[model samples]
Target: MRGLLILAVAVIPAVAQNPVVHLTNATHPASREFQVGDRFEILITGAANQSISVRTTMRGRTDWGPIIGWTNTSGRWSTSGQFEKGDFGDWSEVWTVGGKVANPALHFSVGAPCLKGGQGFAASTGVNLVISCETADGRQTFGTASDSEPFRTPDGRVVRGRVRSNMTADQYHAEILQYLITSRASDVRSGRHGDEAGDLIMKMIGPNALNEDETRNVLSIIRAAFERPEPIPQTARDPSRTLLLLRNLADSADRESVKQQIVETVAYVLAR
Candidate 1:
């Protein structure tokens, strides 16, 4: 995966002037190549009781965006950001506290050399950076439509891009069902019986993808997977933590009925 994680340090000193912030420990990958989808974390510090905010902007672009507030901990704060090849370009990050701008913005680039065949990143063109789908011949599709397209139905249909209009109810349910089952199976096979499967399910279902019946069925499947007595090779499975996954999903449910059903099911399992 081509990506960069920059760790920055922001210092608010006793002197009133010249508040400086810069990346201290920049760990370059052995390849020194960074691409979209890679994340960077910055460690920031502010004056006691000072409020902090961070924002990033593409270089030479008029708009500065994704402004976010920092969570302070004893005059120190740490925040992270990710690169999405969609908006591939030179980028800069600025920090502010108590309405004072921190001098010198952090800068980086997201584009080709990171991708196969040296294709430049384009926002309109979806880019897949996390998972590599290289062919057995070591051939990679770069700059092609298939290069960045991530999710696809088993039938070779792309799942994104006005996808709802194209999918039938049965198709949607089938896709989600396959996703949930596959996620659980993968986690189990990898010796993980924790929240990984649960997290994937929540991400896939999102807001209102599944109806009540679908939700119940999905939860039951997950419950059965968790209940399986597969020995985790690396670490012993924690049943309480496993149960917490269901509880967390229940808490995130928007519908009262769905929430209640998940909660009750979790409780019943706990009783068992």
Candidate 2:
């Protein structure tokens, strides 16, 4: 009864593995910082053949707490758009690629979204540029990279950069005051005093004069004024108005020295 028995064996084929893709390099500003009107490039590299999507975000506190760049407390600006494609806010851009490619380079320029306005006076340690990439189908992530660099407005750059380790407190104060005066003069000559008060607030709160706590408090006042839904009044924007405010604060014995410096700075600017 050893009948003829047949044995059948089933074989399964091995599934192909997906190629490893990742960001090899990403280029940015040489200084790792951004200023309005500045142009820079970001280059990302990886293996080719797969479609990928790239997204960039500005990572940091989103509150109106003192930052070096713009703020939207007044709602005059839109913060919910793509920055690469020209929108505002911390979330920057989302770009896609469909064809085979080994490298992708992105170009950008700092604009109004990086300017406009701000609240509070906390010195921005800086913001981070967070980048992420993923499969077009969103199934697999390529990887992520971040640049913990600060984004500064033109004014911010000027004020912060002017601080020299070799400078005495008085020297620092005088130089910054002179800068404010020159800036105000330029505005006066150009007949555009736009945001002069705002500019003053920025310079006065520089690292030279106030302690961190004082700077933050003063900035809070400035922030409250701008948080109004209505546009800031021109009178409020007046440099003289800011001077008056500074003078009033100078009357406080504790803030006398710093406030006097700011008052002198504003006076010099107005005199110019």
Candidate 3:
């Protein structure tokens, strides 16, 4: 039966020496209470690597069906593996991401083969386990793991909860967004003697001080950022506050274009 796909996992923490994440299941197929159509939810924590794997075994040949369904952000992640009802019916799949540098995510999963199996022709609905991990250099990531316990598709419905689900979509969005912005600026961390250099970059298009070339570079960066599918009309009145604070670091011969670009870009973004 397709309901045979129920799986639960838990990762235990390591003791002494190097840090490690333990993974196992408390209630597995061995549980007498387990049912074919029974769905559960599980969660894992602190997973790294921008990529995580998941799988399940099929019961038999005639009992299996084709593993099918498409991911929403599929093509962007450089992911691997495939969905198939294997020879014995072990349907497995994996998702690789665009590294933590991209602020990758998993919004929702619909029409998975497993859902149709156990529940007959009906679809199994729930919030798929979403995890984010870090790069080798420690870049922030998202969607790298899943529930450490058994969470049926129904048990793991979307639209998060409080307490265990206190963190809402808005909060998660802010977290991922900040992680991305920080990653982009990490290379320039040392350039800032104080906060002045940062400020100057923020007001890149501003008049007085920054030469034409400097403004142009800053404008290019700003324009490029706007080109992305970013949320229009950002709430950040002055994202360059950090840039302004770093303005003092501007070099003696720094081109003026950069400064003008900074101001102009800020105006353009705020205007939208």
Candidate 4:
């Protein structure tokens, strides 16, 4: 089995209103785990009339400190941030907003553990973050209502958790696709069968002569997935299925079609 990081998530209120503030991976939803060092984006939408205030605090389950995103005054804005998990555990990102916010979106990155100072995050699995929103004044004065929602940090918990029967079909699909694209060569050579699948899948995807920037920007995302720790549980899904897909992908008769499918599927999996 491949190693995975686990993080703790903050509990969300059951009867909270609909969230006006939202957070997402720069390329995918929060259900997916991002490699350490990878960057994620933040977006804020909605209509804020008066002076608004927003504060987001994130803490990992382990003792590694917290990743915080905040705004003292609010308006309309779009920005990006990244997280660094010193040690592995469940990490959570909490967002609190006061004032008028129409529909704010947040985009950010997840750094890779192998990155500089990533040893802390790599020591274990990962951390978790939860997102929530509310009126700073606890009233409708901000032009928005109090709303809260829980989001699983893109850490491997979702992927591995699927085996224990917690993930949806879409979540599982995203996990598998992420594994295929990001598993690295070192991990493959580390006597791991899953990494072997990733190695084979990358070859099957085969950049196919893409230009410099195009290849780097496009393939980089896929490759980054391979570099992160495996989030899949041994019992969650059949490894054979993944290997079979990779092998079938190499078959010339259906190569182009499979390639297109992979591209489309990956794109959909990472879309905002």
Query: What lDDT score is found at residue 154 in candidate 2?
Result: 14
> If both were scored by TM-score, which would come out higher, candidate 2 or candidate 3?
2
Number of the top-ranking candidate, with TM-score as the measure = 1
lDDT by residue for model 2 (1-272), tens: 01111211123221212211122111233454333223333222222232333323333211111221211222111111112212122333323222211122223333222222432122222442322223223322111113233333211121122324577754554344333332332222211132343455444433122332343344333333444424655554555555555554454324455555555555554543
Native-structure RMSD, model 4: 18.9
Q: Which residue pairs in candidate 2 have backbone atoms (N, alpha carbon, C) closer than 3 angstroms, thus clashing? A: 71-117
Worst 10 residues of 1 by lDDT: 58-67
Q: lDDT of candidate 1?
A: 0.44
Model 4, position 103: C-alpha lDDT score: 34
Q: If ranked by lDDT, best first, what sequence of candidates would result?
A: 1, 4, 2, 3
Q: Candidate 4, residues 161-191: lDDT per residue as tens digits? A: 1132566544444445434333442221222
User: Candidate 1 lDDT, tens digit per residue, 1-272?
Assistant: 12333323345433433334544322343433345445445555545445554444332221222224442434455544454444344445556554445656666555432434543333333323322334333433333233223322111122343245677654454445544443444222322343334444544433322334445665766565456545432333444544655665564355798888787767655543
Q: Is candidate 1 or candidate 3 better by lDDT?
A: 1
- TM-score (C-alpha) between model 2 and the true structure: 0.20
Write down the RMSD of candidate 2 (Cα, Å): 24.8
Candidate 3 colliding pairs, count = 68
